[model samples]
Target: MTDSADSRASLGDGIRFAFGTLTVLPVRVARWDRAAARAGMLWAPLAGLVVGLFAAAVGGALALLDAGPLLAAVASAAVPAALTRGLHLDGLADTADGLGSGKPADDALRIMKQSDIGPFGVITVLFVLLAQIAALYELYGESWAQGALAAALSAVTARLALTLASRTGVPAARPGGLGAAVAQTVGMRTALTVAALVVAACAAAGTLFGASPVPSAAGAAHCALAAVAALAAAELLLRHCARRFGGVTGDVFGAVAETAATATLIALAVR
Candidate 1:
């Protein structure tokens, strides 16, 4: 095969890996090697973009039918959960339980690995879901466009967090599992490039879609702010988890993704 064909095949494998692992999308992952993982992490936001668009469509449809912002918000918030089979949420719950346990790192990790949800997990999941729903409700109340933007922005930001988390210098907490497979697979430069692109696209989206056909600086700024805030919030969580767990885990990735998404939603919710 020519170099170009090899590149294309590699790209296809990456997309398959990303969607297969990050979503319930019916793509078959052709490779599970580091090369594929590297590509997949870089492509993570693209998978998120699809998920976000679907989420926005669902919520917008509900709102157009006059289901009201509350129902629309619920449906929008539920879409990501449904698409990913609630893996991220489950991670969020497990991470919360582990962190809130106030136990040693090994013990906490053990707690996170457990199947049952603990009190801390339950409470954390409840509040996080409430916050997401509440923020979506506020945005939907303002306009379906706003709600949809928030939905899409949050999803993209969530996956972007995963990309950053997988960058070089970050280690896996365990020797095996999804985290180990992808951890440190992405180069710092590659991760930053993907992140910069995502932010620019989001800002451009806001500017184009804002109040009118004419570009709106305010809309662009609003989106840029949300994206930055989401990254910052996710970064903080990633740092803490690294310190707490000694490195990243599948659960930590989930926790940071949810954190970024929630932060993005909250940032957009503010008037």
Candidate 2:
């Protein structure tokens, strides 16, 4: 009983840490050890879930208010940035600049650490953000329900990338920072378990939302497919980053999340 209670407490800390680190949420994390960080990665998807719900709510409300899809798409796209202080977007930009430079590993890493965004970073962010808005606008035009479901699931799927990237076989790019701190902290078994749970939860949520008031099988499938596609995209990005950068870094994780989310949204918008 004592051991179970301790485990429960640690899990709680992990959840808190996940939210604290991933979002601009005001939740306080009581622990910051390796154990807590591992636990945090396991629960990171939940942070995405929160972000998704908020984005969905914003988009849904705009749709209800008869706002055009363009405005709704822009607002929904902005929600994650506002909530997370655009952290993932910043990572996406930095990673783009680094990778686009085609420099040696050390120079690429140095470029990524720089504060200024290069031409590659500028173009990447511009196109990526435009793609997200365009996709969400298309989705919203199809059905408000579809837009909401896609928004929520995309967020969750994107965050799932973090767990996969932190698995035991993945290494840190450098000696310190979030990459080193979380590198190899998640075992394969743990990552698979988390992935399974996330998929299940997303499916259930999609079904619930898809069926409310007006049911649409196509909408539900879109959500599920978006999740799967997002995961696949993240996995590909992770592998590429691992090879290109020597291993996964915190920036890599962010880039994966944003890219996955964008890809999912785009997939959902497809006919």
Candidate 3:
């Protein structure tokens, strides 16, 4: 009983840590060790779930208020940035600059660590953000419920990438920091379990929402496909990072999440 209680408490701490690290949430994490970091990653998708819900809510409210889809989409896009304080965006920028430079591993890593954004970073962020906003606008224009479901699933699947990236056999690019701390901490079984659960939850939510008078089999399929696509994209990015950067880094993880989210949203926008 005592051991079970301790495990429960630690799990709670891990959930708190996941939220605290990933978002601007007020949760305070009391522990900071490899064990805690690994535990926290298992719950990383929960943070995405929270962000997605908020984004969906924002889009829904604007739609109900008769706002234009473009405005609604922009505001919805801003939701994740606000919640995460643009942490993922920063990572996206850094990773772009690093990889685009085509420098050696050490130099690339150094470029990623710079405080200011470079030309490559600026271009990458601009294009990616615009793509997300445009895709979301199209989705919102179709149906508010569809838009919300897409947003939620995209966010969830995006963060799910982190779990895959942290799975055993993946290595850290450097000796210390977020990547090293959580790298290879997630077992293959754990990653697969989380991925399956996320995909299932998204499918269920999509089906439930699809039954709402309109009856959209496409919507349900889109949600499931988006989740799978996001995971596949993340895997490709992980392999690229391993080859280009020597291994995954904090920036690489962030880039993976953002890229996956964007890709999912784009897939949903497709007719």
Find the candidate with the highest TM-score and give its number: 1
Instruction: Give the per-residue lDDT digits (tens) of candidate 3, residues 107-205.
Output: 999999999999999999999899999998998898887777777878888889998898888889998878887888777777799889888777777
Candidate 2 weakest lDDT stretch, 10 residues: 1-10
What is the C-alpha lDDT profile of model 1 across 1-271, one tens digit per residue?
A: 1222223337888899999999999999999878788888889999999999999999988888989999999999999999999999999999999999999999999999999999999999999999999999999998888898889989999999999999889899888989999898887877898899999988987885467878998899889889989999999999999999999999999999999999999998886
lDDT of 3: 0.85
Model 2 lDDT tens row, 38-66: 88888899999999999999998898789
- As for candidate 3, its clashing pairs are none
Each candidate: what lDDT? 0.91, 0.83, 0.85
What is the Å distance of residue 161 in model 1 from its true position?
A: 0.6
For each of the candidates, the C-alpha root-mean-square deviation to the true structure, in angstroms, is 3.0, 3.2, 3.1
The runs of at least 3 residues in candidate 1 whose Cα sits more than 4 Å from the true structure, single-residue gaps closed, are 1-9
Of the candidates shown, which would achieve the greatest lDDT relative to the real structure?
Answer: 1
Instruction: Tell me how candidate 2 scores on lDDT.
Output: 0.83
